[model samples]
Every structure is written in structure tokens, then in C-alpha cells.
Target chain A: MGVNTEPDVLPEARVIAVAGLGLIGGSLARRLAECGRRVIAWNHRPAPYEQARAAGIECVDDVTDLARAVPDVLVLCTPLKAMPDVLAKLAPVLDSRTVLTDVGSVKGQVRDEVKAAGLNDLYVGAHPMAGNEFSGYAASDPSLYDDALWAVTFDECTSYDRLLVVIDMICEGVGDRIIAIDDDTHDQAAALISHMPHVVSTALANELAETPSRNIAQALAAGCWRDMTRVALTDPDRTRAMVEEDAANVAQLLHHMSDRLESMATLLESGDDEALAQVRDFFAVARPYREYKARERGGAAHESVTVRIGGDEASWRDQLLASAKRGEHIMHMTDRTHAIAEIRTALV
Target chain B: MGVNTEPDVLPEARVIAVAGLGLIGGSLARRLAECGRRVIAWNHRPAPYEQARAAGIECVDDVTDLARAVPDVLVLCTPLKAMPDVLAKLAPVLDSRTVLTDVGSVKGQVRDEVKAAGLNDLYVGAHPMAGNEFSGYAASDPSLYDDALWAVTFDECTSYDRLLVVIDMICEGVGDRIIAIDDDTHDQAAALISHMPHVVSTALANELAETPSRNIAQALAAGCWRDMTRVALTDPDRTRAMVEEDAANVAQLLHHMSDRLESMATLLESGDDEALAQVRDFFAVARPYREYKARERGGAAHESVTVRIGGDEASWRDQLLASAKRGEHIMHMTDRTHAIAEIRTALV
Candidate 1:
């Protein structure tokens, strides 16, 4: 099952079937189609199915119909909980050549399920670290994954070349930066970066909700509170679905975070003259780490080009889209004033 | 001494002496000067004094000189730890006619010190809920406190009318929204909105710093982490000084936050069938609270008007300042493409 180490071979343009046309799936499908790859989408829910169809995407209504389409690459973009069941249903139709992948938050569980279903050779677990507070098919954009980190996990026995062929196509199509790690490593990193942070944000939000003077406190809420709790605005059901798949990792990180908070409280409560100094030291160490992170993240492989334009509000918006299409990676457009607009483009 | 407050009587425009020309002090001084009020600034540090002097603000080198000026309103803008000593040194010269106030995060300590000095009637504790990550006199802007929340705490025996007169004067001068809370209430709110969150952010940053994959994680860090840890980038000395004054409240809130995190971790680790549902419910309650806060904040008394202009980058910046002066409350200007600019002004 080991992949052949062929550097120059690109995979053929076989039909790519995307299961679950939510934000990730819809965006991937749109991006792949835009890149001249044949993309067919499947959605269990009629709303997203209709959305995909309305967006000019070819939609397969049934699992059998999707399996019959015989896609060379099958991407499972369903929620974490739904992936196992979806995999079970699709397993019967998958062949050795049909490389299977997924865009789930936690990869360990999905990897285990794929192994249990005897599809390890065909599976490569992937998670693209790209999304917003908004979700679903309607919010999907073709460039959602542009310049974003995409973590892919491969087992030792997996066909690395074959998996890379598929991944490289998707990455190239969507302009994603590839980050290869094992399933366990990927899940651990996800806990650190995504899952634990979500829990922390929710806890902060919950505490604020329980405050008696929440109304007054809310009036006093500034940039710090807003930034700390922005992720708490996500759909509750979706967040639950995501967190549950990686519960143990999330819980472990939360426990560690709790310990950290307790230590800070203890230092503050010590009443020693040096207590403030200790607190100062704690933050002093953390400051550089955060600054380093910010600096490193900013230095990622993304080149931004700013373009200036002038127009009315509607015209500015229209010009923004036009510039985005022409540039192919416009990240955002700021309306400087009524007459001036700045379009920031991230070159692929 | 009770301040004689007659309904038709306005306090005479006496000199305003602002001590410690840091970010808050410098901005207040600039705003006061811009509002046609004579402002004299004092800074213990030579650099800030020089900066204030360079900014065309009147600076008093000595505390007695400031007192000799006989300011009707004296605003102490030093750090929390330095406030008591600064107040003690200036208490002898501050007569009953001069209404004394200090802008400090923790109001209880300042309130106690003022009472200890028998200057209760002449003292009001204030905490302006405004600042940027950038600090010092150099970062000060005349509009720093525009549309910002300013918490003012008055003791029970204080002359309410006189305090209100001084507060109204200061608030109007700085363009801050008045949120009158008691010492304890203000501290508690400050802990919830500012201090505890800083600890949480530092803890999170510390955890990342301790990770072996920190360098990689830093590379992969995105918006959520960026927002959550932004305040962690501030000067540790300043943060410690602020937190130490409000240590008890901050510690208590941090303990509460620890408990919340512990509970969330417990729920995640329980392996209950309803765990996902419970998590969903937890977040659902919090989402609306945060949304309400954001909506209310947005609805604060500020009307932003956008004006369009076209020019080169340097000329656009100049035009932005010119428009801001003409508009009187330009909150921000965006550089829309190279040709056009948008200036957003908040109407007074």
C-alpha cells in the first residue's frame, strides 16, 4: 500500500465527488470547478443541495448516485459526527483507486474509523484551518481556503504519492498551504489551536452571561472582551458537533488552562510584596511568545497587493469584485471614503 | 465642604492641570485644549514631559508650580501604584475650590486614599474604558476618548451636584460616555471586562510558549488566537501595576473563570450521551448575550458619515486629516484602492 515516490506525475482529471456541500465542501467544489476540475457535490439536506445546484454545481441526490459517478477522489466534508456513518455507507462503493479524504476537525477518530472499515490505504485525513463565524453553503466562497493552513494526516502504510497527487490537486486548486502530520499530532494541534480556544471562549461568554451587572459590564465591554469571545458567536450545534469528536483532547487542554488560571489567581491572592512582580513576570514571558506568533503568522507565504479605486458605494463593491476576479485572490476591500476604495489582494 | 450647585450657575473656567502625561493624560490634555479649555500638563518622566512640550502643551515641572496655577480641576493620570504617593504629595496644595480626580483602573484604592487625605468632597475616582495596545504620550490622540465609556465613582457623602459638575466638565471635554458606578462595582466590572481576560490571554500564550510545536503552531496561528492574545502584547509593567491595585477582584474573577473552565472540561470528559447537546445549550445562552453587547455598543451615541476622495497615498492622508478637522469627529479613514479614500466621521 506504500505510495510510489514519483515527483512529476499529476493525477488525471477524474470526477471529484464531494459529500456534504456545507461551507467547506461547497467552497472546495467551487474552487475545484473553477480550476477546470470536474466536481460533483452531494448534500443530505435539501437546502444545501439546492444551494449547490443554484450555484451551478452538479449535485448528486443519493449516495448510490454519487458512488456510481465513480469519482477518482472522494471528499467527505460532513460534520465530524456524521463522517463515520457517511463513510460506512460509501465504503461498499469505494475501490482501491478511489482515494478517500475528509475535511473534519478531528482526524484521529476519522482515521480510526477508516482503518476499522478497512480503507486505510484509500484514506488521508485533512483539516483546512479556514472558516468564519458564519457557516453553511450560502456562506461558502471559492477562495475560502486561499493561503490558509491545511493539515493532512497519513498513516505509515498509506500510499503517500497517490494521496499527495489528490491533495496537491486540491491544494493547488484552493491555494492552501500544506501541513503534513500524523492523525494524533493533527488532533493535538487542533486541540491547542481550535478546540480548547472554543471552550475557553464559551466559558468566558458564559461567565459574562451569569454576571448580575452584565448589562453595565456589557456597556463597558471593549476590544479585549470582543476579541476573546468572537468565536462564541458560532452556531452552537455545529460547535458541539465539532468539540464532541475531540472531547478528550479538548478536556485535557481545558484542564491545563484551568491550572494556568488557578496559578495566576494564586499569585494575585498571595499578598506578598513580590506578588505583583510575579504576575508581571508571568505576562512578560507570554508577551514575547504572542508577539513572535503574530510576527511569524504575518510572515507566512502570502503577498498582498493593494489597488486603489474611486466610486459610489455600489460601484465600489462592483469594482471590488471585478478587481478580485482579475487578481484572483482579493482578500478584502476597504472603502477609504466615498470616492476611494482599497482592494487588498493576496497573490497565490 | 459641600459644593454649592445652583441650577443656573456654571463653574468658572479654571485651569485644568493634568498630572503624568501618558496616553490617557496626554489625550485628555489635547482634547481639553481642543475644546477651548486651558490645560497644564505635568510629567515626572522627562521623556513624556518633552513629548508633551513638543506637542505644544503647557508643562509644569514642579508639583507646587501646578498647585500655584490653582487649577479648578486637577486630573491625576499616573499609574495605579504611583497615584497614592502622587496624591499625597499634591494634597497639601489642593484647596476645596479645586475638584480633584484620578483616572485609575481600580477606584476603591484611589477612593480610600482620597478619604484618608480628607479630600472626599474634592475627589472623584474615574476609570475611562478607553486605550489602545500602543501606549505612552506619543500614541495619544485628541479623540482617544471619543464615544468611549468612562466609569466615575463618587463616595456617598460627596457633594453629588459638585461632583457632577466636574464630571460633566471632564466627560464633555474628553467626549466620553458617563457610566456612574460605585468603587466596588467599577472594580468588579473592570475585572470581568479587562483584568481577568488579560490573565486568561497570558495563560493561553504561556501554554503555547511551552509547547514543543510552538514555532509551528505560531506559523499556523490565525484570527481567533490573534484576537484572544492581543492584550497580552501590552507592557507587563503597566499591566502588573493595574492588576495589583485591583488584585483581589481580578483574582476572584480568575478563580471563577477557572471553575467555569473546570466545569466545561468535566462536561466534555463525562462521555454522556447528551454531552454535545449540553455543550450546544451552554453556547446558545452565551451567544445572544455577546450579540446584545455588540449591538448595544454599536448603538452608542455616534453618527459616522463617510466621505470619498481620490489621490496619491501621501495626499490622501493629508486630505484625511483636513476632512477630519472639517468634520470635527472623523473616527477613521480607510484607504480604498490607490485612487479613492473613505473618511468616517462620528458626528458630535
Candidate 2:
């Protein structure tokens, strides 16, 4: 309950502007509106306008109209490829009070685009860990954002006050959780978890495709192979774009995974007592993860805790990043100085 | 319809002995009885005996009791670790009229064990692509084998008549499909499609577990990461045993996968036009597989065909292996000379 000089800190995001109402934006806009926050949306196409309107989302034609509305937070829900043009359009019209954000998979790329557009002062990068194989406005559902964990990213130039505003929009307005982290950490983690795995899956599919007895191999393929290669079935163009956007991180992870596989191969080939023991070690290396998943299957419980943010800029940011690294998801802020988080990602 | 020279071919396995009443064996026992075949079963434990009787399956107290019954085909369904012991007990009492078979995952190793027990002459190697996560008779269901594809493996010493007996048990008694190939080919394909992928999944899980910001990466994980790592969450002890049994093939495939990943990593780091082209080619290399899956998803039809099996021993075995390599699943024996197979594993 220590709210003082930062009166604008999470002053309850009342009006929200959503530009580019695809599946993610459409779902976000609908949920925010359903949660009682006034929503103004604009899409590249008018196809979703009728249904969005029926769901109580007001639609506009021009992208700049969303900026002109001067909502508390204006989220650019366009694809990463379309971000530059959208940011270009909103550069002059976006009100200073409207904290800019996005639902892009990569944060650093989007932040750089925002900075290039001279809107870095009003920017807060975000990525919602929510989506299905299906996309477009028609496939969007308000519940898509239900209980979702979002990465709310920042950098040296990010305003603490603006971040609090976006935090309020996520935790309170959108009824979801957030982890406030730096842009680089968010991108690296995203690549580690998603992008690198996509490339691995693709490589597996390639292996099967290239095998001489492919038909025989495919015939004998079961749950393990099927599950590991499922993501390789996704649209390659889209996957390629996502990987290329975060090349360095994905490449680094690919190298690490290559080394692990090669090392395992060597041990399997050795056939000696020591090699066998090392093979045992290779599988045992993921013991922590296996235990965590087993506990998750057993419906492990989460503990809730509160985080205090009352210090200089660097220390405050460091505290938040540390909380995020510990896997504490900010559910909501009790006041500008305190945030309630749930310890759901605990490995042990 | 050439039946004169090989009268034992397609003679049919009316009475069956199942050694081990765990999930795979128990389900097979029940399914055979339900399909009107006399089913005799034995287990190291007697927990499933009473229940087995109720299901019309004759449960024997001792493993030797199974051989004493002189069933038409005796299936050693126990774990690989228990194979030698079970085989030794059956060796002396087993009837020469009985064709020996087992539903082991790896065929070459099992055949070696059977040879060591002096029962290789009667042995027929079989592996059903079935079973869920559950084990034990209580978790077994008759429908566990519904429409399953089984690999019916052989070697230089594999008698054609004994192979036919096992084929009769699988195709008619158990109502499944079969693909007869050499033991080495089966092991190679199994390693390619299943064992290697399991290790790769485990490697990915290890990466996540060892990450400094593991909690953060886990939080960001979605369907791609979850699916790719699903098998890694399997019991490590069991996974290690399976990998060790098929070490050479798995090791070779792991080496190939590592090379693919490392190549991609180099291209990703290069970031030049030529490097990007190579990166695109890396993803494009899987085009054959992606297209195959796309066709599979579209409910591609399987055309019926009859494969002839008559010639000198080596040529006939080669013909069958070629048929399996073409993904033809033998549905039933049309006669001593031909088999009805469905062209199901069509990759293109």
C-alpha cells in the first residue's frame, strides 16, 4: 500500500487500443472488452468487423485511428513483418500517454523497430504464450488469453511508470499473469524453448525423409517419433521467418543440442563398461526435468508470494528480473510498490 | 496356390502359449481367446491368473507348464531381461510341432538369446506396434492391438514354416498386419524411427533442465516444446534399457542428426545470402516428409495388392524384405504362394 510519487503507476488501464485484429489481437480485444475495459480495434481487413462488433469491440478502418483514440495502452498486434509499417503509421498520431506494446513472439526485434520509429519512450514489449495451430479473427476466442503467462519485456530506455501501466493491463485488465524481463532475456528464452525445438523437429523430419528404408521406418514409427516431429508439420515459411528473426539465439541453441546428440552418439558407439555408464548418465542428466514433469502430472500445488519494488531504477529492474528467472509470475499488483506472484514454475 | 512343397505354410496357429501376462502378453492372450483361439498363458507372478481364467485364457502356474501344453505356437512375451530364463525353462519340454515366437521390440537380440537357448530353429521374431503407457494384466485391454502394424522379423536360419505360423497368429488370431523383414533391417528401422528420437527428446529436456533460467524457459514452453519433449518424460531406466539394446543403430542415427543440427547452426551463424539459401535448403530437405504427412492427414487411400512368396530361400526372403521396404503390410495369407497386403506406408 505504498503508492506515492508514481500516481500514474498502474492507474488502471481503462481504454485499450488494438491495431491488427487477427487471432491474437481479436482474442485480446474481446477479452479486454469482456473484462469491462473499453476496447477500440483496427484490422488490416474488414472481415472480422461484424463479429468483433457483435462481441462489443468497436472497429475502425485506418490504423492511425487506434492511435488517435489515445487509449491508455495501444497494442500493435500485427505480424513481425508488418510491424515497421504499422509503427511508421502510428509514429505521429500515437498519444504520449498511450503506452505502446505488442504480442510478437520476439521482443528485442519489435523494440528495435519501435525505437527506430522514435516511439521507444512509450514502448513496452510483450509476448503472450497463447495460440493454436489455427489463426485469423474467426478462430479467436476470448478464453485464449485465460490464465496465460505473458512476457512483459523492457530495456534501459523503458519507463517504469509505462511498464506498470502495461502490467495493469495484463494482470488486471486482461485477467492473466506476467513476468517483467529484459528484451534480450525474453528473446533468448523464447528461442531456447520454442524456436530451437522447431528447428530440431524439422531436422528429424528431414532424417526420416532421407532414410533409404523410409517407408519401413515410417511404418514402425510410434508415439515418440510422432510427438517429436509434430511441429515440423507447421508451415515452413512461417517457421523460417520466426527462426530468422531470432537467428543468433536459435543458432547457439542448435549448436548446444548438436553437441549433446553427438556426445550421446559417441557413448552409444563405445560399447565398453565406461561408455555404458556414460550412456546411463546421459539419460539421467535430465533428472530434474523428469521429476518436475512427474510432479506436474500429479497436480503439484503452487505457492503465492508478493514482490516489493521500491529502489533505484537498476536495482528495481534487477529485482524484477530475478523474480522472473525464479519463475514467479506476477498475477497482479496490490499497489505501485508491491506485486503478488505465484510460484508455479518451481522445478524442485 | 502352390501348397505341395510347403504344406506347413498357412497351416494356422489354433492353440497359443503366452509366456508373461503383462500388458502386451495379457492383451494378446485375451484377444486370441476372444477371436476363438485356445490361449494358454504363464507369468512370473500369479496375480493375473484368476482374471485370465475369467477371460477364457488358461493360466499356468509354471513357465514349464506352457511348454507341456504343446500349443501350436509358443510366444515368449516376457521382458528381454527375462528372455534367457524363460527360454531355458521351455527348451527341453517344448514340442517340435510348436513354432516359437515372441513380441520383443528388438528382434536380432531376441533371436540371439533364442539361439543361446538352442530354440532358434523354432523361433519366429515378432514385434507389435502397440501398447499404452500402462503395464501389467490389469491395465491390459483386448483392443490395445486394434489395427496395429507388426514387424515379423527373420534371419538366415528362420524356417519359412515357423515364420508362417507366427504370421497366422498375428494376422488371423490377433487380427493385425505384418511386415516380414530381416532382423537387422527391423532393428535399424526401429532405431531410426523410435530409439534415436527418444534420445533426442531426452537431450532437449536436459538442455531445458540445465538452463540457468530454466524456470523462465519452462514458463515460455508451449505445444512445440511439450510435444518434442514428451517422450523425454518417460521413465529414464526403461528408456535407457531400450536404447542400450539397440545401441549401434541409434548411435549412427544420432550422429546423422547431430550433423544436420550442426550444419544448420553454422548456416544460422553465417547470416549471408548464400548461408540463408543453405538454411532454406536445410528446411526444404524435409519437403518429402512434410508432403508425405500432409497426404497422410488428407486421409490417403491404401490400395490392395497380393505379393507372391515362392522361390529359393534367399530370393523369397529378399522379395519379402523389398515388399516391407515398400510399406506393404501383409493383411492375410491368400495361399502358400501369395499374401494380401495393403499399400499403407506410401511416403510419396
Top candidate, metric DockQ: 2
Model 2 steric clash pairs: none
DockQ, model 2, C-alpha based: 0.84
Off by over 4 Å in 2: A1-9, B1-9
Worst 10 contiguous positions by lDDT, candidate 1 chain A: A338-347
**Model 1's CAPRI class?**
acceptable
Can you write out model 1's per-residue Cα lDDT over B199-246, one digit (the tens) per residue? 888788888777665544554457777787777776666667777778
- Give lDDT tens digits, candidate 1, residues A20-133: 888888888888887777778888886877666665668877765666777777788887777678878887877666678888778889888888777887887777777766
Model 1 regions lying over 4 Å from their true place = A1-15, A45-61, A112-118, A171-173, A273-281, A284-288, A297-348, B5-14, B45-61, B112-118, B136-138, B273-281, B284-288, B294-348
Give lDDT per model, in order.
Answer: 0.68, 0.89
Q: In order, what DockQ does each candidate have?
A: 0.24, 0.84
In the order shown, the candidates' Cα RMSDs to the true structure are: 14.6, 2.3
Q: How much is the TM-score of the A chain of model 1?
A: 0.76
Global CA lDDT of candidate 2, please?
Answer: 0.89
